[model samples]
Target: MLAVALRHLLLLCLCVPATPPLLAESAAPPAEPLSERQRDQIDAAASYALATTLFASSDLPAALHAFERAWRWDPGEDQLLDRIVPLAVSLGRADEAIRYALIRAGDGSVSPEMLRRLALFASESEQWDEAKRLYELWLQSTPESSNAFERAMVRIELGRLYRRQGNAAEASACLAKIQKKLLAAPNSKASRQIITGLGGSLSQVYEMFGKCHLEAGELHLAAEAFSQARDELETDAAANYWLALLELERSQPLDAYAHLQQYFAAPGDPLGAAPYELLRKVLVKINDREHWPAELSRLREQHPDSLYGLQAEAETLAAAGKADDAAPLLRRLIDDALSEAAPIDEDSFAACGVWLLRHYAATGEANRVIPLVSQLGKVHPSLDPYANVIKAAISDNAFAAQVNARLRLVADQPQTNPAELLPAAYLALTAGEIDLATSIAERSLADDKNVEGDDLLSFAVGLLLADQGEAGAGLIRRALEQGAVDEESPAAWYYLSAGLRGVDDTEAVNAARRAAELAPASPEFAANVARVLQAAGQTQAAADEFAAVLRRFESDPDPSTRATLRETRLSYSYLLLQDDRVDDAVEQLQQVLDEFPSDPGASNDLSYLWSDRGLHLQRALRLAETAVAAEPDNPAYLDSRGWGLFKLGRFDEARDNLAAAVNATDEADPEILNHLAYSHLALGDRGAALRDWRRALSLIDDAQQGLLRAEIEQRLQDLARQAGVGEAPEKNPH
Candidate 1:
């Protein structure tokens, strides 16, 4: 009975809470429970409480040990197993966690939260097979709890695993499942957020698909994938812009233009003027067919100061044949652009000048060219050559003369550009100073030692020498030997071949033939070769070549080339007149005058032909007067007028104009001297005529020496017979 009482005391000691101990050491030992069931219950309760504390502090190793001991004492404590499974997962023991989770999940004892945690942990550890299996178990055991968000997240994780493994098709299938679920429950905020988070991963999958297709050269499929991604994205300006660029790369300008317009209109896009400028070019191409006036007008109104808008307006007006209207707008744009103090690109400046030149030339508004020239002169000094040429076209003689004088000053300076000197030389030649022109041309060519192949400067000098009837053959040979004359160099070959023909070189004639063969499509080259062949006595070949040139280039030849061709035909007519083919020459001159009614040279030449042939002197005088008024300061036109007046018996007017032409410059022009002599002779001033004629003969070069000598001899004989003086011997022109 005492033993039984002690056992009961032990049972109480184990079951009840412990009492507070005294401070002194020496205390009696307390009895414990003797029943196994009570011992197990006490141990289980203590272990569970400690495990809870350990689990709360995230001490998974200790928590697992305590939980295992709890489970061992109370094997039916399935809740302890549930706690231990999650702790195992928290400790990165996913395999152990999943094993226990599956067993409890199968027994209908595991909570859905615990199963879900186990599956996510397995997925995080890249145990995709285990993660997938556990997720399936959870779904099967708790199908009612399998909502859209849970199912979508599980599929998204599987998709990511497949994507990592490079199984894009399988990955895409998984991602599609998430998309389908989200779409089906579009109003669910939780599902939408889940899908949105997964959107990035899905986008990457689409990008991978697009890139693979692109690498395989399947552009259409690649474009389709890119389109899918673009549609899925909420805010991706770069992606949209890249799609437009891809369209552009495929030469789908219309599609590209549409996409780019949309991109530019989108909010918060950072692509700047690049897209707008490209769109302008595309619009210009489409504008050829589409009447986009309102669209262009809107762009101008909304973005009045945008460079692209200005360019579009300028192009539209120019295309519509409203150059007069376009000129002011272009000027305003230039001013506005300059006022912005933005750094001017070279292209912008060049575009401004090019637009103005096109408009002014097209409308025949030569006066409008002056302001552009002046503006270009002030802003871009490197463009002085083009500016001076435009300035010289001004109707105001004083303004034109001022421009020529300024260019002369620039050309005379020691540090002046050698490239600019050639034009200045031509200006001097036109001003009737052959000696100064020759000097300038020679000096310019000498200074330009480093001139590149086929440049304008080298070609200009070669043409200048040839036009002057000087030793240009050597320059032509030098240019060709330097490889400056090739298929790409039409202008170079044209000028060099013309120069060689001037010197009667057989080698040059063959080289000219080669140039024609190289660029048969070049009208200027063909025309130049024809002129040379005619000069070299190959009339039939020259005629055939000219016919071919006219046939090919009649539609859209360069204006300058057209002018040169007209002048060449006029020259050929003059040659025919010299050959005593008077009717044919007259017909040719008539055709030229009919074709180019505004050509001053053709008018002057035709009038001179009429005067020389003694046909309709009054008409010749009228045409020559008109020519002189058109080009008031031109010495050639002035000479033509003076000759025409002399032919019409207006000797006094002729004398006055001829004297003005003679004193226009220091170096005498042979043609001007001849005109003055003829005027003096017609006015019964034989002595003055002889003096002028002798002066004219002295001014001519060796090429014209024979003609001058014959004229002088005839005049001398006529004077001797008229004045009762002995016949004077022939005097050498040299």
Candidate 2:
């Protein structure tokens, strides 16, 4: 009886109640469920109550051990993992939970739900391999239990796994399967049902699929995926960033601009650095930069060691056409990256050095480039010279010859990093050794992308140089046939660009559309596409795209967006006014003024528009006055204000302001000079008016110019005739 009592106590200590699972919100759910047996056996063993009591007492670890023992006593009590797994998770012991889940799955003690629970747990724990295995197991449990949607989701997980493993082809295939499925029957009842089952969450699935295509360099496919995702489902914040990237790469600046505005407006993590970095690049490329200095300063302050921040200072200077100023900043970055950091970023240091040398070479500062390269790159023989030959060698032949010699020597070495061969190949190409360059480039291409698109870039350079001739078409075909990609290529758009270079316009556009689905790095590329579209008479489409671009800067925290938007509105309004679209022009200018009331340019534009049409004289005068107050020395703004005063019949004041405007521009602009003549006519300064008219008339031929110019010419002649002045002086520009 005493032994039985001790046994009961042991069983009691070995039993615990079920604890809840740690959430695996992002993981897959299982389809089939097995029958679940209660703790009847544990109850019969007399330890279940004690374990439950211990669990309630918050002695979780002890209770978990008790539950395990209780299950052992009654081998039929297979639900111990269900209780123990959650308990382990609750205790912040993910590894322990994984172990329990694995044991349950291994021993056939898991129901479908329990199995899925384990998979979710593993995934949430970032035990990706283990989670992947469990997901596959879940898929294999029973074919009938899982539907096509569930299977596709599993495929997506596999695709994600493949992507994570750097297997773009496999990832692309896995994702493409879903695309095919959806495309096969997009509006079918079955498809709709599957989507409904996922709570109309197919967009998220499509987004993941798009990401796979993006990773695989299938730009067009990515674009399609993103479009479906964005249009059908919830407006995901991260997806907006990807769309912005896509628009940039497509050269659809306006579209990218709009996406960026929407992206920043989303209540996502404000500290995310990618949006700002990409935007800076986009803005610089379009020469529509806003709040540039402050934006760069923010990046530096927030992410000093980040690639974006480190590159910003130099890139911004270069963008501003200040190569001399850029050189020092890059040099400083290189020096600091080389020596000051605790774990010096050797790669960054080398890249910066390469860039600085290239800039020096480009600007004809060859005397500076060689010394810098020698100190930066040659000092570290172990470093790759991929960036070395890219810019500098192309510009400076002497430096090229010297660097080429060392690069080839490095390539001749038995075990050099593949990156070293890149510069060697480039240098060989520059030297007219096409065959050698081709061979060396192939060798380098066989290596992984050393710096972003280096491998594909090498291949491209080689392809261009090898005199592949008409074989270019065949070569592209072969590339497609062989599924050959430059090593672990992340240059996804290259797939679209290369395949559709001159093949099929429809296909090219499709491919571009897909590429735009991902996070693109080239807004210029997007702008090119937009230009092509616009030239093709897709005016409305182009307009829509540009409108999207305008939306991008609307809600930005950076003042750059406001500045950019103002300029955009300024141009848009100017065009509208030129077209006699008075209402539209006013609305556009009103938007700029409403958003940036203090903007002198916007104020001047608003005032001038009203004054030009002889409308809203009082309001125009106030706006002009405000603009004049803001930019006292700006000739254009002063002219707008003077025109406003003249429209209000303040003749003498108009003359004074118009005189300043003429003097400010050295009387260069024809339109401003025309306005000054009108002001002089209003003030009865016949000689002054005659002289200004003569200059304006000499600068413009009535027959060769627009309606406005013709109007100005007629007005000048009328004023001269009325004042009884002689015909205009010959070639009097001053």
Candidate 3:
């Protein structure tokens, strides 16, 4: 028996024969058939050995030739075809491999191993139908074979073939069979090898199954399949990741988050970083609901190395208003990212810095934003507008001066951005340098002519020009013609009105009226329009306009606008008092004080009205003192306080406050100086009083000039008569 076995094995090896005598040029004899004994001796071993030797010798083309010869000689020897198929593939001979693979594919003599080799070759050559047909034949023929391992592998390949052919139902049937086979197989090396060899990746199978189910629109089934396959996978990362993705597609974020948490928990899991990122997004979507903090905290604790963890923690802190805590964490992240030897990505760093800066500003801790700004300057110096704006806003005088010097250096460079001129205009305006402001504003406007309708810098320049008098009228006309003006623009109209009022033009008053009509809701516009009406010598119209302004802006939330409305109404009321409408004037002033109790201007004006009427002397004194306390540096408020005290017969106190007001003035304001002169005269200091009244006369405009000149002339004559110097040449009051 041993001798027969050895002879049969030897003949099996020789049955393939040598290279067919190199296809000799001379006529060759026909090939002889193998005897029945020799054919019976042919087994898997001899075929495998011959194929291995030819393949190992690096004679791939000859090896495939030998494998084919061996397969043809013993047609039942499916093992030889198996050896031939891969060898043909290794030699890039797809056509030859397909020929041998088809012959043994459905033969019971063909082993599961041979079917796998054939399927692989067919798949590599993109012979999807042939590969599927071969795998299906092997699967059907070996349904009960002990080669469950090979059977499982063939099923997986079959599944892949069907998947590629877009036959989802057939593909799912093949994969489902393989999954059942794998579940039934014993947990041994062979079974494990089969599991591993099914494309050598369990995740791939699940991914395939997932795709099959998804394309069929069986999402729940897909999720369940993916979930089961993922559980079988030792790594579980990919499985968990796919499962999470499936849940996300279903809009079940909470379930997705749960899967992501598990994925993040596995150490060295391939999907650790990716799952943590998905978890963060999921958490953010439902963060406004309950239990968000727990989810965010879990992510932070579990995946400290993940950037998404740090981002989640930062977002959590910011949402809770704990910006102080978020800043240090963000700084550490930035430092670690930048310290790496690799080049930093500017876009990523800028996005992080922008978030941090916005949070810092929100918390009102502008000083804490310097580090982020400094880092941004290093990485993206060219596009650092927000950084520059923040730096300019947070710094005081000394720091502002230093920043300005540095900005000047940057601006002087030839490659400086023209957009930098906008901030330069703002800095100049804030520094009270009008010429520099004008130059920067003009440059900014020229560079960026698409300036928005309500640009604040343009409005500031127009207002500054208007405050300087008639020299600003041409500038206002140019601004109006530049298409920068809009009907609803309050500042434009204010400037237009002031320019017209300076030249005493009624056309400007009409334009102001149009502006008021456009922005009737704006308190500032109404107040300016009332002032214009008063300037146009329409007192009754002015009073009615002031009343309209107070009513319109009664619900306004802005403190500054509210203060202006109160002050304007009080001034109109005082005008009424001058016109001997005492009852109406007192009612308006009382209403002003009642409406804006914290406004020092309203309080002082009301007090002045009261004292001028001589009805509420004690109450007026208290109100005036309160006004001075609120705005001690305001000379107008101080003068009102002093006048109130003078009316109350506290002449000494009145003199001290009035003198302080007078000395505080850089340019002599006629009304303030006149009040000081009146207080001094009431205190019996005639010389000092005379000196102040004369100074007041020199500072008045044409309207106030007439009144001041008359007062000073009368005071000078009284002083001359008291000193016995005779009336000093009666100077014309007009």
Candidate 4:
């Protein structure tokens, strides 16, 4: 059996192409001549053989573990995903499946089914934007011969998403397309069956239309459509659920109660106990506490085994500050799921573990928390971060020591998996073992062939934020070097450029320029090149690059691309303003307004610029008003409007707006405070003006706010000289 196993492992190793050694054998020390790549190949082959044997033996969990180990050792082997993705899906490890599927997507090998599943998972997780993107991508890849029902369902979902995003016109257009597709089908028995499955009935369509309006806040229209839908599909219970929601929104609790009753009486609510929570609300509104207990009982009976019941009970206990009462129930739910020989949902299952960990930690049960972390980590590798976090909280010194010991062991090994080291490195960083974490991270980067550049860059940024500048810059250089060889994509170079910022000016600009050269059609990449050039103080070249990208996207119709163009224009205008080109800045702002007429940022910025120059005071005030009306609570908008009002000699109104702006924000913005100070000075409150100016001056830094600081200081001096009282500040010490 051992010989046979060795033969299988040898065959697997032979089948896989040999990855290039991390270091050439000639360059390696005589004592340790085996390169990291050769060690990884051995590890991957052994793990793969073990995985295959376990899979044949029907030990799926062990098989999955072995497969993951193999893949971690051999990330460049794309074929390993063939087994990994399906196994993860079958094991109900949605996150794992999605992660590998995304890798396959990058390699352009993702299946339509995988894409659809990922989209649904995102939607269920309430990551609406990601869900919309995935759904759109899946639809684009789907063929015409795809199932009619599934296609219609996706269209309905798209319409629902559009409405939820407040794009009513797009939602309406989506519904029209769905209707048209059904109507366009051939008139035959098979066609009719397809249409019926596609939800072709007007009533069903109207119900979806009502949902769209509901999400888009067209409540009255939603009610009308729901009413029509309810009449046509009187027995369909779903219409009743929607009608109940509409009635609740309209504040007709009695009607809502009736509809909810019909909805509850129906066989099953696809929404689960979501409506029961609403019913509970309606009962409270109607002051009918008598039915509360019975309703709770009905819900408990509906979802037996204390599934929803235990969750609600735990929540109520926690809310009431009964931590002791909630603990057992939480433990029961967590233990039951863990002990059961059934497939588990990774996210939901791990969420319970995290909650229990939190509870245990809060109660000071480090013992309980440690064991639970061990249990949960076995079930989901993603829980490692959370487990390490909990362990650190329990004893940072002990955890750091544990990580250091593990690091030493890993270092002693001939080859170390970067994946295994990353979590420990992050935990060490979190535990304030900066040197140890940096060492681990450096070791991870040593084998650059398998290094994920994004992960390396992320760790580098983390180190930079943690005040390890030199070390961070070194890792960033390593990531850039790896990305240069492996990814060689515009986005990769652009991100690497961003990573190099504040570290190496020349390299950052070169990387950004390389990205632009690689993808001249990408406005974002080109804009990034321009921005980096501006940062490098090559103003003329920056302006030229900006102009090139703008001209390239001049007639582009993509909304996202147009938004990017608007942002690039704004950035270009800022660059022009910094160079004191007032007319050029105005032209850029005017172009922005022409393209995005109601854009509040452009309006506010333009108004501020015009007010600052004392040019077109009336138009600036109107523009400021427009911006304020759009984002009434925005401090910057209020500051612009107040400054415009101050320029117009409206001291009372200006002071009010300025004060409101000051009071609304947690931070005392120097510019806003300066405007408020001027308003106080105009109102003949020199003492108040002096105080505000001092506060503003204190907040202003000498770096970028030098001019503003000087102006405020001069104003203070003038006011003090006029009053002939206390002396003003002489100058900024720094």
Best by TM-score: 4
Better of 2 and 3 by TM-score: 3
- Stretch of 10 with least lDDT, candidate 2: 33-42
Instruction: Kindly list the per-residue Cα lDDT of model 4 for residues 569-662, writing each as its tens digit.
Output: 8988988888889899887887676445457999999999988777667768878988999999999999999988888888899999999999
What TM-score, over all chains together, does every model reach? 0.35, 0.36, 0.38, 0.52
Q: Any idea what lDDT model 4 has? A: 0.71
lDDT of each: 0.62, 0.61, 0.63, 0.71
How do the candidates rank by TM-score, highest first? Answer: 4, 3, 2, 1
Candidate 3: pairs in clash:
none
Better of 1 and 3 by TM-score: 3
Models, CA RMSD each: 45.0, 32.3, 43.0, 25.0
Lowest-scoring 10 consecutive residues by lDDT in candidate 3? 725-734
- Model 1 residue 303 lDDT? 52
* Tens-digit lDDT track of model 2 for 1-734: 22343465566677543543355445446535322122234232455556678999987755765665455334455565578667765665555555556655555444555456667767775778777767766766747446776676667677777778788878888788778778689887657766776567877777777878877778788888888887874557667777777777777777876777676555533325567777777777678677667766864665556543556677777878987887887776666555654223455566666677666556655445434543553334322464445543555577665555555554566575554555555445545555555555445434334422434343453444455422232333343334444322334443444444454545555444445444343333343343334444455554455466565434332334444555666765655665677898787776665444456787788889888777666767878888989889899998998888887778788878888887887546677777778777666566787788678777775665566577666676665575477543322111
lDDT-wise, the better of 3 and 4 is 4
Worst 10 residues of 4 by lDDT: 725-734
Candidate 4 is scored at a TM of 0.52
